[model samples]
Target: MASIAMLVFGGNAHAEGGSYNVDDASVVGAGKCQLESWLREWSHGSNGLYAVPACGAGPVEFGVTLNTGHGVYGPGVNPSIKWQLRNGDDKGIGVAVATAATWIHGRQDDAQAYVATTFGIDDARRLMVALNAGVDRIHGESTHSLLGLGMDVALTTRWTLLVERMWTHRTITDQGGIRLAFGESSLDLVVGSERSPHPSHWINLGWNAAF
Candidate 1:
């Protein structure tokens, strides 16, 4: 019952931008239910789940994120699914690969797929950053390309931070935002803002739980 509720409210069931409410509930497991309600108002309005194997044999990590936003399809919202892989030194030097798909629903429902790669950097302290670039294809129209860059900084062992910006030739589509994470698995706070050239800007705040 609780898991189902979190999935509905925390998954950006009704969002308009590429970001989701701050406390992106999906990141937490099943033990932090107490913080869900408040988190609905404090996050970036995007949900992402990631897994990193205990850096051992060869420094490999992978993760995924679901983005809820509007796109080439129409006024309806779309879901963007992504898979990422990283390989390099424990200090954070290496290459990262990512591929994502978005399904747009409505009049003419269109789907898009994107693939990108990034270079990683790690100061090893509390700050880290990565860069990515890729191309996007819209089923029937010309293939639209994109160049994106982002950074992640861990303020502490339990607090993670994110900043991302992307540019494209199309109007009313460029976007970016920031995210902050706190706690381990059950409690957290997130704040973020995003914009599009149509030109609208939105702010989000959320608190989340996983029990």
Candidate 2:
């Protein structure tokens, strides 16, 4: 249960700016700040609240996530950093590396790291695709490889569609959502399902802002 949230929301992208599960490249320009918050309800009698606040400095972004609620084993904390390697102009391939450590009840529980790639499909910047692959190192469990693929489409200035499917050898998760913008802030309504700890479905209401 905890692994699903961490990988789905915090691992590569960690709610990377907009889309839910797909890790997007850094967009927080130097000296800028942003906040992300979400309220989630699961079909199997569980719910949670999450908050992520982040800032940018040069090519790197620093952030942390606060998770709280039920049905989740470790609603701990995740502190992470991401570095943009190089921005691709001609091929539209942008790359980044993100790493984070999780602590539950004051004890380190797990660590995650991922290399993410974003590919632009058009010049208008209306559509984008992302790929993330990483390693999950739990305190007492054997390490596992994590991988995910996602895509987002901008239907208009105020509307965007997001879809993602991420997995490892043992778990699979799928998310679909719509983003509605209000100036520098946006709201999202997402539906998701995961195949771990039992088959579960959830809905999330998320809001993001840049400052």
Candidate 3:
């Protein structure tokens, strides 16, 4: 019942990775792959299981997001591709173009494309920043322009902080989270809010790994 409600308010369902609502301008690497999964519970009363699996080939990464409502409601899958224009290292600047198409079961389909930039401000502290500008086209509705900004700071060897905000014409969302690194994988906890006609607040716990 609760899952059905929030699935209707699918404003922050954009596919990136990790716990941020905004996508970043980085890819795993050539021949490298990653998997991200999370469990979310909304303050409005709902739960979801989300997964993302992606791999990099050449200058591009192919991925998809799986969003399910506790095995109930389905916005099913979001297929995405990211073309890395510049490496996101401690070099000058990094840039990428990302696009995704969404199909929510029984609901309308939507597609989005965005240009993103990432910068490494402090290599010692592992401080990074990312920004995005995009447009989302709804199947039966008008196109909505989107903007986003995000940051990640490594607080310590095992702990890192993340904050991000994304806005569209119809809705705005913000998220703050932390990651606890354990070698190749990490655990995540995120809390976020969305501003819309019917607001939804959620808490998410996630896992991320690279291979």
Candidate 4:
């Protein structure tokens, strides 16, 4: 369970400047909750801290994140919701729709709405692929479309690997990470790069707990 949460929200650390990233299509089991926290440091000496607590009820999941950072956009609150449309199985795929709203200090609020799909691959179903496309709206600004692709591969009983690429307008970001699980908790270490005319590197360390 902890490993799953890391896979779902780990790449969120790469989100900077109000850009959206791909989110997982799966949810925690009903009545279950997950807590995730991460610290991100960029090559330019800026850093941020993020914390998210999510709960699943029936076929829907709800989450909110507290973002405190030293960047163009300061502190913020991000709330999100995802509804499971289908559950993945040996013979079928999974789908979900998610939306997130962001309110930043002294800046225009932003929102994103997207649809995501997941497919189980390989004979053991240990490999999964996800794709998402969505629209982002910034208050008093033009809307833009976003696209993302991601994969999760199980390396062992207690290890998993993640890779993802996301595009929003002219900016493209890529992320890769490995998750280590111990009992009901996991740790994720991720490295990512972004191209917004110039290249910048980001490193993230995340901890996830399931309860």
Candidate 5:
């Protein structure tokens, strides 16, 4: 399975005055299920855990992510749906469309809609590049546009490198990570930095299992 990135915390978090975000564009295959969990710690004393369970049905994928923190806020949940418009092959490109709705215990709700496209850079289709563009609407606030660029390179049969940058509103975040795969599961370690407005840094340790 190819590594898919999940949107950790985004404009919704920012809307609540929090500064953490992760975004990705990979999908579980038809009739497949993916379980992902990660913990993100910020430079400041805030930290949280993001756990998501996603499944694929025909050309669409569905997921729900739960966010729990130990700092300035309570728990939150995000439910999302993604539709694969085109499936990329060894010689072409693939595209998907997604939307997520966020609800936090004491904050306004948020909704995000985006389009993702992936292309194979190698003949074996092991090297891939993905791009995402979207808009996030926070209830009672202004809408913000989101953009992201990422790449996945297979290092070996069971190892891959992941890198990406995401921009939403005036916040920009850069992330780099490695994925080690074993059969139907993988482990990921990621570190990222945020700039301006609320400058901060974070590290994410995660695991992904597919069935």
Candidate 6:
């Protein structure tokens, strides 16, 4: 449980501008859940488990944001790994791959890993194109698959924009969001929706800082 929280928090940290440097790659992310009801936590000893079991690895540093219309919870950890193919001058490029997984109340939950191929022009203007694919086991009885493609743009040194569309093999998802960096700290907001077979939405908001 503690480890799971740590991973989430770590992702949040990187998103918050903690400076994730991996083989020349630096990453930042922020967003909000489209719906609030889907984001629920386990009650102590109430879920018939010691804690939600989870484990993952990535850049060793990350940041996250969870947002609700009523309030916000943020700067969480995440599991991610980033590799920089080129890091210098105004032109830079890299590839980052990461995944974070957890089981809520033994319901068997998991999040797929994403691979982002990013390129930047003039250092401040960043463009990222990526894909996500993963599977989840639910209720010890069923398994679900996820696939997605997304893009991100840095408006400036302090602002970023992102848009994505995903499919769970069983459902469709639409994600749109933005990010802001304040010196050593950062914040993010994102909105998501299910568009194909049904109608649903979620939002996420997060904040984090460097060590």
For every candidate in turn, the CA RMSD to the true structure comes to 9.5, 3.4, 4.3, 4.7, 4.8, 9.8
lDDT of 2: 0.72
Pairs of residues at least 3 apart in sequence or in different chains that clash in candidate 4? none
The clash number for model 5 is 0
lDDT of 2 by residue, 18-73 (tens): 43755766546689988888888888677878787888889888887787755575
In model 5, pairs of residues that clash are none
Model 2 bad stretches (over 4 Å): 1-5, 8-19, 88-91
Q: What TM-score does prediction 1 earn?
A: 0.48
- On the 0 to 100 scale, the lDDT of residue 61 in model 4 is 83
> Once all C-alphas are superposed, what RMSD does model 4 give against the true structure?
4.7
On residues 1-211, what C-alpha lDDT tens digit does candidate 4 reach at each position?
1111121122331111111245656776699988877787878788777787888999898887777766635477777888888876344687878887776775537777787777877868688777878877667878888777888788998888888788765677787888888998888888888777666788888888889
lDDT of 1 by residue, 1-68 (tens): 01110111122110011132111101211122122222223243333331111111122212222223
Clashes of each: 25, 0, 0, 0, 0, 43
* Alpha-carbon lDDT of model 5: 0.66
In candidate 5, position 38 carries an lDDT of 75
Each model's lDDT: 0.31, 0.72, 0.72, 0.68, 0.66, 0.37
All candidates: TM-score: 0.48, 0.89, 0.88, 0.86, 0.85, 0.51
RMSD of 2: 3.4
Q: Per-residue lDDT for 91-162 in model 6, tens only?
A: 455554444444333332334444434444344557654444445332344666645455667788788886
Clashing pairs in 3: none
Tell me the tens digit of each residue's lDDT in model 5 across 23-105. Answer: 33446778888887777777776888777788898878888777786573448777778887877634477777888877678
Q: Which parts of model 6 are misplaced by more than 4 Å? A: 1-93, 96-99, 111-116, 121-125, 133-145, 196-198
